[model samples]
Target: MNGPTILLVDEPTSALDHERGAAIIELITALTHERATATILVTHDRTHLTAADQIVEIHDGRLHLPAPAC
Candidate 1:
């Protein structure tokens, strides 16, 4: 039962050491693209953030989009 899928991972890399964390993030990203699945990776690491196609930040219970440059 699979065509396209979605993965909602919360703090998925937080527990691992640096190398393992990076590896895990890479694995997740690879699987998402390879399987054509939509992945919502919830992480505080800015390094992993770049791997996302789009990013939504939340603060004080509010969602924030990137602000327009002046």
Candidate 2:
């Protein structure tokens, strides 16, 4: 509650190996939930998409947002 409300991470794990990348993702996820902070993760890595609650895809210079989860 004392930290910034929004967290922006760009290519945080780009230079990391699979295991290390996953660890970074896990740490971010934990912080996001624990702090109740909104997180925007910008990356081209599809492997980490599973950690997302919503997925946004940018293709052809357009943004595609997923349907609301029900």
TM-score of each: 0.83, 0.89
Per-residue lDDT of model 1, residues 1-70, tens digit only: 4675888899988888889988998998999999989998888877778778888899998999987769
Candidate 1's C-alpha runs over 4 A off are 1-4, 68-70
* lDDT of all predictions: 0.86, 0.94
Backbone clash count, each prediction separately: 0, 0
Q: Model 2 over residues 1-70: C-alpha lDDT tens digits?
A: 4689999999999999999999999999999999999999999889999999888999999999888879
